[model samples]
Target: MEQLCDCDYEYDSEDQYTMPEFHQKYKDKLPLLVVVSGGFNGKTVYDEVSTNQVIWFHRVCQQSRVLGRLSNQAVRQYEEFVSIPVHSGHMFNVITSSRNESDPETLEDILTKHKLPVLVRLASEAYDYTLRTVKRYTILLLKTYTETFLQGNCLQDDILLPPPLLLAVSPDISVAIATGYVNKSKDTFHRKLRQISEFVKRNVELKEKEGCKEITLFDKQDSTTGTGNSIPPDLLPSYDEDFMYQDIEPDINWIPPIPPNPGFRPSLPARPPDGLLCQNDTPVDSEMESEKLSHKQSSDVSAGTFNSLTVYDDDESGYNSSAGSVKSYISDMSVEDIQSLLGALNLTKYKKDFRKHLIDGAMLEGLEETILREDFKFKHVEVIRLMKYIREGHMPKQ
Candidate 1:
């Protein structure tokens, strides 16, 4: 009614029936045993279907079963008996004739009587099981094959694989296998990476063995105490050997190095002899001329010379006598002498231009009278001493 099936059907003429014709005539009958052969000989049979024809047959029977046209028992029988190939490697043959064959029957008569629909259905079911088994087994086999391939080739100098086998590999499955191989390789790489520090240390040790002495960057041991030597006696405690080894007691008399006292002044030297105008002439005299002059003034005043008050300007010797004028004394003084004079009078603000500023400041302070007495002699001697001290680069006593 549907213009027959369009599928190009092949059958042995002696069998007297095509698969489609058999299915159409006896669609509702008990399953009949069918012989299956070819390509499935001596080799181990994989569960998967080996051809497209098998796939097509499996789909047809599966549809028929779902539509309630095929019995569950019939499908089960087909799966158990027909799906699996026999162990024998020969042409599989089945006889559908009854034991008593007294009645004559043609090939078509035998096929129709036995019901070809049942044979077709059985064959289709077998193919379905084969296809499913092939798919599942293929995946498992592929995983094992890929793992072995990676193990052999991942780190090899020249990687090699059978081109046909590689071509047969599923792209997704292959990628998964390759990723696992890479991960395993990474673990190996990490282990190798950790050895880098050990390698460096080994090289350094080797260099030392070869007599390449390393330079010490810093020495922890004190240089002064090394070389079998002890610390200096000055640094040691001042105690007898027995006392030193025993539990020690603090010394009440032990004193720390004393710092100089800021308020203490050193006593100055005695005055230089008469005619010794320059301080350099009495280089070794520790006493300042100011102190000597003060002493002289005290003695003179005690002898009643304090009231005379007049200072004499001795022009020839450039010395200001006890009776000298202040102006003549100032005129006879050098720049260094003037600076010293200013310093002694506590008028250091005039030090830059001491001669003029000193005269101004002295007049402002009305120091002429003071200069005529003890103060004048002291200042005069101080100027001479300070000039000498500066020239010799000596720090004068305060």
Candidate 2:
């Protein structure tokens, strides 16, 4: 914990049964900076400070799939520090599940729960690889870089580093660099980050000039502030990336055709079904509605809200409404429903048009490839998968 946070923190361990009392004591001072670990028989709490500490703490809890609770304010604050934009409602649910029991202590405890020395060996190997690529530098310079760029707390320890700060260009190494070491310069960290970023830029350009394709974070043409270079073709389909587009085609026996609708008709429901509120079936014709309902109910199991974790009932197919149930079969799927589907499929590029045009499953079932390509501006791959999703009512086999 000290290594990850780079600060001195007070620790407390209490039985799970006594957590209610502990929480009551701290309830008045809502949003205390602490790491609550739901270990078996007891809970381990760390008095943490700073955004990164909270993130790493939550990350550990998340990795272990333990239950954690954060005040609404803490959740919002953590979102501000995340490099990628997070959905305000679903952030809490993703990082912590409902299982508030049996957590492992220490990153190494969970990281190498079964294997011996895996975490240590992995970190050592990462350091060794950095050493190999950075062989031209002297030991002292390497040490300074390690402490400053790799371990510096200037940036958030995100799953992916944004743009020019993509040190090592490997998510595992980037995370290891973020959480594995510590540097405790509070005020001048940003300035140090700037200097290191500049140094990286110069080194990368020099390597490119020397015809060395060993390591590079950003392209020479794009501005440093702009998006970084496209990932190398060699690393194009990462393990997760490989699976992202998989299972999006229907099974062989479930094949169905989606004929083209003449003029793309918006799929906005004429009115909500009896008992359902307007908010429950809000149209996504505008940006405000799109932002509000697009990914609010993203998960398959539950719909997340600001104050509470609400699971969908057996009868309710989608989000909760004041009426107690939401009708969301594919035939009656709303704009928000399709938008959420796009989000789950990681097809964010089509989110705008899909929502703006009120494209629901009914509309999707009739969308033609030419129309999708020309009018909606969807790629060939996207059109294929989307049609399959509409026809099969689920992600299909690749």
Candidate 3:
């Protein structure tokens, strides 16, 4: 019979029920209440302790932290309440029962929509929302909401949340309204949390003043801005604003500078040794040897410096019988040519006047280079004729 029933039983003589017998029947049942009354009084009954209401709110806050600690300390508790249970426990029942007492519908909505695939998505989204809202509320309550709730503010843990949440929330406040934690919008949940918080503070004050036996809640002005988390001002003398506050919000600072022009080319000075050789002195005599050597060296050095220039090396055969070449070349040359040629040699404005000097140098170098080259051919005849042309302003007989 025992094998057929799949039951094992033990008997207790005095109690009329055996330990194993009673356990087999009732072990799976949820405890009707565990710490239900004290937890409820702390959270709900004393929630409105007038100005002294923070006592109850503080207890509720402590309870919330306790809930978190309880939730985390025993995964069984969180799993069972947040979802269906893998295993059963009496302690989990206590937490869930009280946890649902404050807001039944919201809890119901979560539970009603609960399914495996849907719950996984909800769990992920919930984690994200929880991370964001917790950071915001904590910032407001601890950093900005200057209150003497605790003597030293033991719970004011400096929460350094990630920037991604701040970045994500930034756009939501402008479009959604203040639904901090509960609703999908920006205004509703966040505003409500702060409203409750401030309300609790006021009630705490009234309770302390009135010496009330019961918790008494009161109305409070909405202290929080939809954007800013109702943080307190910075103490610095320079109009110190809150950390969340900014002079220019949503504007990305520190952009890159403009790039330089790629095609631009700045010119350099046309190098020295730009003068022409005189039209007079021709070689054949030993006396002109020194002049020939100096002129040759000068031409070579000039060539070394300039990237490009015209050279005149074989022009010793020009007829100079009519005039002096230097004087004649200067005078016969148009005044416009003189100014354009000479004025271009100015050292300043190196880039602009650069090409002009090269052209002038080209003419002069060509003249000297020509003389040096053709001195053998022209002898005194060609040189003398060219010199005369320069002195008197006429071309020598070719």
Candidate 4:
């Protein structure tokens, strides 16, 4: 009775179909496939294009986005597929052949594993393999950036990702990676985003090039090394060597400096008085003056200075300075300090996530075991240890 969005037909809120009817209607047809005018080859028989080929082509299209423009264009030209402007449910139906089940294993366990043909089984394997490969690349990219940029390692040059291949990395992951080259903060968020956009655009341009060499991420050679693999000399002109230059001898002639005009009058400073009364030279009634001055000083101290000092001391001196002094608190620590704390605690694996979340000194001060376990997904023992460190004031100080 539940409504499902089918890509083939106009969306109707009231329209609903049972599992058997939906499967029978769309089992042979590809998901998100629209029969465009001249989209399919004339000689190609529709029946010959099996569901297995459809699924294979679907995944090829998806993965080809990051592979290169030629591959994507080749797949699109040879296959009739519509990826954009389609319902996710419709696509899921094609791959899984299930009206309700969401997991890919459902196709293997209940659908393809029993009733599906050999080709369908092969298609499922291909889909899983390609998906896994893409995921592996994404993880590798994250790890590389984290190790080089986040873990206090020097990243001397700008990060250069292979064209289109970097497209496999999501924007959020890209932003996190950008943190290596850029500081993560409210002010730099848009700058990072703009930088990521430019990278994508450049990658796209490279992807479109007919002869763009496919360079794996992190495999790029260091240009500073001046190795044989470095960019060709013709690409960059030798400005230093080609620029015209000539040395000229210095002139030895000397000229006399100009003298001030005799008619010009210079301002003179005012003279001091002949005599002045010095404090030490004057005599006073010391005994009486000292007593009056002492009385006035005591009154002023009691009236204002003493009270103000008392208020300031009371406000800040509530805590034992030796026990939990402001200097020993973690609230003023930096990201590097947090990393040092993590190293001291032996929780280095969480450094990337900590940086990505901007978990600074102040956040650590208020971190709860529940937050570490649930939000950060830390293990129980790790959470316990961290909480213990926090409670005992064992965290690294600024």
Candidate that scores best on TM-score: 4
What lDDT does the true structure give each of the candidates?
A: 0.26, 0.31, 0.24, 0.30
What value does the lDDT take at residue 30 in candidate 4? 22
Candidate structures ordered by lDDT, highest first: 2, 4, 1, 3
lDDT of 2 by residue, 1-398 (tens): 33332333223323211223433343344222332222111010111122223211111110111111111111112211001101111111111111222332332233233321111111111233433432321110000001001111122442212322111111111111121223444345445444545544454322111111122222223211011212223321133333212223212233233322222222333544553324444544666655555445344224423223343343443333222221123545545656667765657677655643335555555566777787777788887777656544446445
Candidate 2 error regions (>4 Å)? 1-243, 247-249, 255-327, 331-371, 375-398
Off by over 4 Å in 1: 1-89, 100-158, 161-398
Question: What TM-score would every model get versus the actual structure?
Answer: 0.13, 0.19, 0.12, 0.22
On TM-score, the stronger of 2 and 4 is: 4
Q: What tens digits encode model 1's per-residue C-alpha lDDT throughout 1-398?
A: 11121212222323423233433443344122111111111111111112101111101121000000111111112211111111111121122221112233332233345433221122111234343432221000000000001101111111222111100111111010011122246565344334433443343221111110111111113311111111223322122332112232323343222222222222433555653422334333334775775577678656544324433224533443322333333344434444554455454544442232222212322343244234333355554453332223223455
Query: Residue 189 in model 2: shift from native, Å?
Result: 27
CA shift at 254, candidate 3, in angstroms? Answer: 28
Off by over 4 Å in 4: 1-314, 318-328, 388-392, 395-398
Query: In candidate 3, which residue ranges exceed 4 Å CA deviation?
Result: 1-222, 225-267, 271-398
Kindly report which residue pairs in candidate 4 clash with one another: none
Model 4 residue 213 CA deviation (Å) reads: 42
Please state every model's RMSD to the true fold in angstroms: 50.5, 27.3, 34.7, 30.0
For candidate 3, lDDT tens digit of each residue in 1-398?
11111111111222221212322333344111000011111222211111101111122010000111101111111111111211111111111221122222232243344321111111111234333332221011111111111110101111211211110011111111111222144465345445545654553332221111111111113222221122123311121333322222111332212222222322533323333232233333443665775676578656642223333222333423322234434433432343343333221222122222212221222344244234223345444443333344333233
